[model samples]
Target: MCNDEDTIKELTVGRRVGFYKVRGQIGCGNFSKVNLAVHALTKDKVAIKIMDKMRLDLQTQWMLSREIFNMESLYHPNLLQLYEVLETPSRLYLVLEFAGGGDLHTRISSGGKLSDQESKIVFAQILSAVKYMHENNIIHRDMKAENVLYTTNSCIKVADFGFSKRVNNRNQALDTFCDVWAMGVLLFFIVTGTFPFHADTVAKLRQSVLEGAYVLPTWVSAPCQRLIRGNLRSDAHWTRCWVASGSHTTASPTLTPATPPSPPICVAWQME
Candidate 1:
């Protein structure tokens, strides 16, 4: 149970909430704030996402509901785990798995492009998570580097389901393809150290994305280039080309904190 009178300030460091004690702040978004907390009895570290229900619109509420629904039903090692949920008159609380390595976007921003093998390892985990979601009838509409997080084990965990949706029929294929396009964008960043589309404004960015005009750097491996081409252009070719190419033959293995070798083996249909 949660207290309606417990203000946001009461959620700061040294404050107590239910069976958890707040340690410090984690981060904040438009409608929610995250805090580092510890379970009182077990002393287990966890991240608590606190969303102010008063600040959310109907659409945002719907998204949150979908996020909870999707998470409650899906379970994968590479996917961030939702531990518990709590509610009050004014807020919704979600206890989530803490990922110490932060997000892939931050890593890429600090350390240019990753090596081919490193990119492959990270990508394989991402594909595995996406494949699992699709198989479970969920489509992560917002798949990007920022949403891909790393845990203490150095394993990839796909986070954030606010933009995710559950699809039951073939009519939702295009929406799912958007994820493939986003994956292509992420892969381009990992392999070439840059986004495939560049624009000064949102309109221009949308235009660039629709055009799918990107220059593949020479250093990128041939197999990766093929994957990018199949994804960045012609949504129709994405599934077919990836499958026919026989590149999805790798399995995701646990990667050590050392230099990596060839990428993981995966299939195209499995990736989707």
Candidate 2:
């Protein structure tokens, strides 16, 4: 069983945590640190987020509980998978699927903005994951590029549910609309390599968000521009309908030579 002594040892490299062998630190937060590990039996890689019980305030504890509950309830291809939860008197460990390809923020910073086709692929997976979450009554309040991870094969996996909540009422416009607005910001960031709303200070940023003023890059296609506009606008219901219908064309046919395509495909709905 896990004890305080074992928890201290687990923080060091080359220590065992239950069935997994801890390797090195991968990531961290205010009260938790994530370590890379390998399963002893299956030999599969995983990330173990170790949280100190003493550091968690009452509010943080409540958020942590909600995160665990939401993650445990979710089972989607594009959502990060929680393998198991282990606890000691001092620390709590969350075993999760390891995404070796890094996060979307790092990817964009290192390689610049994604191409139209590439953005469509990545955004479709994110959209799919978000749709699944909303359908299940879960709201991922924190939806940003940093939380979007990639597998070794380049598949998208949405992570970080600390700000997430499950609501009993699906018709709650305020809650769901927040996600829609975030989706718009995410799309704008991936396509242009910048946030749609920006300011020097927090107060100014809030004002920018309230004003809802942003200019689409000239390179972005008309349909995608329309989609982004629809998402950021006051009509959250219209944005939902557009996303649900999956009809917006992210790529512009006019930009390229007019050649008959071999097969018709809906790129927005293609998660894989």
Candidate 3:
């Protein structure tokens, strides 16, 4: 029921979102909800993202359509596969690949700190997909852990590009930065097992993000040949600053919060 756990909650008066029989609600939020559904004809399982037209007018709807279009056009193991779209009078249905491992957040929450090598592999896989999207002129503005899904093969697939926009020209900078910002958040959550920049209040969260303050442990700095390690020259520069500030805003920032409390010293990754 993890995917279609919403068998009990009431939804907008209508039949199941699409051909997939409603197993139950997977998850829900302000903008949309996910349901576990099975195909009526093939009996194949899929996750359906149900969004109400009433919530979005022309602009957002167009953006969502673009996201769906982007997913539909791509064929990558690291990206969530989009099947088809089914529309009704009240809501729009997006048929998607059923990823069973769940989002990266669930894995990080239950798996604990990943190894440095593990982090490297995970980040490399993610970067590969992002690089592909970049070449395609698409920017996944929201790249946090919640938007990433793990396939049964232990592969991390980037999903949920609702906040993304395509940038065809080099001059397009607006809204592009949010994508990397979301990545930083994904990293923070992966290592810390917590939303490093999370806040209970909307206004408060906004204020904190603007502060550009976040913290990580100095010990997490493993000796490396890359750019990530060299940046942490002193205590105040990276780890200390973030722990004191509570938000990380740096691009390519070497932010890897305090070490795991204790667990045979797990390998830390670019978590989220």
Each prediction's total of clashing residue pairs, residues at least 3 apart in sequence or on different chains, is 7, 0, 20
Whole-structure CA lDDT of model 2: 0.79
Candidate 1 versus the native: TM-score? 0.82
By TM-score, the better pick of 1 and 2 is 2
Clashing pairs in 1: 248-266, 248-267, 249-265, 249-266, 250-265, 250-266, 251-265
Candidates by lDDT, descending order: 2, 1, 3
Model 2 residue 132 CA deviation (Å) reads 0.2
Candidate 3's residue-wise lDDT over 30-50, tens digit each?
Answer: 778988888779998898888
**To one decimal, what is the Cα RMSD in angstroms of model 3 from the true structure?**
10.3
Give the C-alpha lDDT of model 1. 0.74
Question: In order, what lDDT does every prediction score?
Answer: 0.74, 0.79, 0.61
lDDT of 3 at 161: 76
TM-scores for every predicted model: 0.82, 0.86, 0.66
lDDT at residue 165 of model 1 (Cα atoms):
87
Encode model 2's per-residue lDDT on 139-258: one tens digit a residue: 899999999998743377899999998998767634777787888899998989888887999999888888886788888877778768877987777766655554444532221121
Where model 2 places Cα greater than 4 Å from the true spot, the runs are 1-14, 243-272
lDDT (10s digit) by residue, model 1, range 90-196: 77889998877788888889988877667776787777678778777788889999998877434678999998989877455556667777777888988777888
